[model samples]
Target: VLESFGSRGQDLSTEELWQKVLQEVTAEELRAPLHRLCALQAGWWLADRRLGSITSLFCLLRQAEDTGRARCSQGENKLLYLLKAWQVPAEEASLPLVQSAEDLKETLCTSAAFLQGLLELEAENFPTAFSLLKEAAGGFCSKRVLAQIYTCLGCCAQRMGKPQTALQHLKQALQVDFQCLPALSHAAAVYHELRETDAELQALALLYEALEKNPPGATSSNPRFLMQTELLVCTPVLASLLRDRHPSEVKYLLAQRCLQDGRVADAVEHYLDVLTLLQEGPQQQVPLVGSSALPRIPEVFLEAASALEQAGRHQDAITVCEEVISRTTDLIPRMLRVEEELELPECPSPGEGLAGLSQKKENLRCLAWRAAGYLHQGWARAVLGESKEAITQFSRCLGDLLRVQLCGSGVGLTENPLPEVEVLQKIRLLSLIGRGTQFLELGKHKEALLDFQHGLQISPGDPAAISYLVLALWKLDRKKEAAAHWLKISQSPPREDEQVGRSFPLYLMSCLQQAVFPHRESLSSRLQDYL
Candidate 1:
């Protein structure tokens, strides 16, 4: 009959099963299954609206406890504590069940301390909870119980502002049970507070790995079901912790790892997630991990644009660049308008003075990033054969790059006054190279030659710049000069693995091949040697 009852309970909804047990099962038949059900449900049954029936069930459990049944004492104490924690109203008589901890502890094992610790922890009394958990830890031989005790201690320490202590407790929890999700989650929070980003990510990664190992519905047993449900509940907590903290930086790092591991699709998804957050701001009402600073949004966008282009999503790459362009366009004009409106005295007001100077510096930095974005957009357009549009983009890029101001020697700044100067030079060289390539494709050999020469002045031994210079010279019928450049290129040392041809597109290489050696048979015979 007990086996049949268990089977029937499994087939019914939780509420329906409890109703059936209350209506048809006799008091003597209820004790075992009710205890089992409470353990399997993991306190979910407390959320149901049938409070009166639940209270009556607790009353029966208390009666069993009074009869000196140790198991019943432990179970009744747990249920009563859960009820109090969740603020569920119980009969006045049942209140004594929670206060009967001394009697229960005398009968049961050290779990009585664990139960009291959990109750105090939930009630936000950290010191008492920590002491009780510490006392309980030595008495448990079960890894699961020890893990829970340590995890609770970690939580208590964290709430009390002892991050180092919290981390130690969480580490001990993992030492006991490496797959403890609560321990991992708390460790992640502690790591974030300590500004140890790599550790935080490692903890989060292990947690997700553990969740994947035990997927939902992998088993029909009560313990497995409860664990699966707990995993589901904890998943969102991970996401929330990430979003509340440096989400953009975390996603950016993850994207780089994915790219290194040859997971291009995953990298693109992570990059896009970073862009979306920066573009839309964080979702409303999500709790932050700590006092997180804004991420480097523009730099992240530039990287995502480059990654998209590498993955052959040219149009998407162009769209991300356009976002940078739009932001800069809106920002620069507003900043200029504000600067004009704020009249400066010999000594500016403290608050406004610092804010105005900071804003000006940020505007300059944005201009540099905006120019780079345009350069990337031009390259993307050129790859798609839109030479006219690509040239226009490159022209705009050059204009923005030239507008950036270099810090003067007398500025009194301790940091490198012209931090953006290096960025400007690199973008200028790339802009010249891109525009020159477009000119070469359009048969404007003299214009292409001039552009290539200018880029060479910035980077003397850059292979792409030299190769294009050779192509331009050959196109303009300067055969002698072209041969001289080719000889110089042949004598140059091989580029290091990391520095080789990253900025040079393969299509440009093909174009250079055709222009340098017009005859098909000559190109085929020399292609392998040149490459």
Candidate 2:
């Protein structure tokens, strides 16, 4: 009955209705379609008016979970029917059942069981989750689902602190599906944590090599692995990894990382390379095409501006910031379009809803992420000594953030982000430190002190920061108090990997050593003076 809603009548198709529901496009927009679907379902009495609400709808879906827990049964097809009824999207896909058949609508044995285990594992019901998924190991199913089962088992074992068990599961998972991205990622992480450094690097390299290929297929063999590697490693540490990779977006990264590593000349070359690429590409278009549209500013001009700004060209910096901001309208849209296209889930149908769940406000989340990029970019500008310009950038980003909130999604633009409050606090602390440094550099000693004090309050006793505070106090001529602060810095020794900062403590000790034992210096020099 639901499938009859094409060009024939007011009847709506099940898949289309499901797609729309999964999207959670505001119900107001769904009014007409809702009226029709409701009439048809009501006529058939499958509408389940009692499950009008999302949470209640979830309870109805829980039957699928129950079937998995019961080791698979007749209720499997009923679950798919419920999924259609709920109108979930295919790509933001419903949980796969334990693949009793190629057509999931017929049975939910294989993927269904894995889905149950995944949820249970997440909830820390390790043993139970493990038991549920392992049921399909010997059963007929896709190697992909089988790979997931092994990975889940590995993670569960790792959480239980059973190293051997975890490794065993990882080996099994990899054997089942060598290209399983999640399995590889988790296996690498676990290997690193367990001190299997060689294995860890090997796994990391495997993922990187796979990502470099940009695999051509509906699945891309593991999109998360590719996207996440860029997010996790490429932007942070594995900077050398970018050398052999795509030279387009890579130049910006090289410039940024070079700045991070204090290699100014390397940064200059790469930034120049980016300019060369941009100059040769179409520079006049509204939405610049391809990798050349990066930075949304003329690379030559901006790179020159960056070089000048870093060399204390405040006015020249402002000129660059202004020009880039002006030209950004055309460039930013291009870059943003690229990002949006990347975000689009597999060949999205004209009106399909694309969230893990239909009603989760995922569109709002995606928008928020774009706005966050602006907010972070503003902060980057502020740190590079573009004071007034940074404020404007920050203001613009904050405004965009506010716009996201007003648009009314399930979440709001918060100082604290979802699922990770600790991380937000750390970011806020870093912001405080940045502000403190700005104040210090600009000769606002009192303001700098306040910012430092607040940063200390947020993250008490961090030696790097505490050392900076002590230096600030000493420079401000509070030697006695500052010396005491230095003592606190000395008590916590540097980690083995970071041996450079031990000098600050040593400097303080030398001063104190001289004061405490003024007569002792003569022992080492006794040959000349004592004779």
TM-score to native of every candidate shown = 0.48, 0.34
Highest TM-score: which candidate? 1
- Deviation in Å, model 1, residue 512 alpha carbon: 18
lDDT score of residue 483 within candidate 2? 64
- What lDDT tens digits, residue by residue, belong to model 2 across residues 1-531? 223322222455543444435334333444434433432332222222122332233333333223443322463433323433442223213544332112232123333344455556667787876776575454434566566567768878888788778888888988988766656666765876776655765665565456445431325334322111112111111121111223344345445445434455665565656556556665312233432324434434444444444444435444544554455433222111111121346676766636432222333333333333333344456646665554445445434333322222322213222322222234344445555555566677676677578767765764445655765675577766666665555466753422232221111111111112122234224322322
Model 1, 311-350: lDDT tens per residue?
7787998998888788778665332222222224678876
Q: Give the C-alpha lDDT of model 1.
A: 0.60
TM-score of 1: 0.48
lDDT of 2 at 431: 48
Model 1: pairs clashing at backbone N, Cα or C within 3 Å: none
Model 2 / residue 293 / CA error / Å: 27
Model 2 RMSD, rounded to 1 decimal: 18.1
Which residue window of length 10 is worst by lDDT in model 1? Answer: 506-515
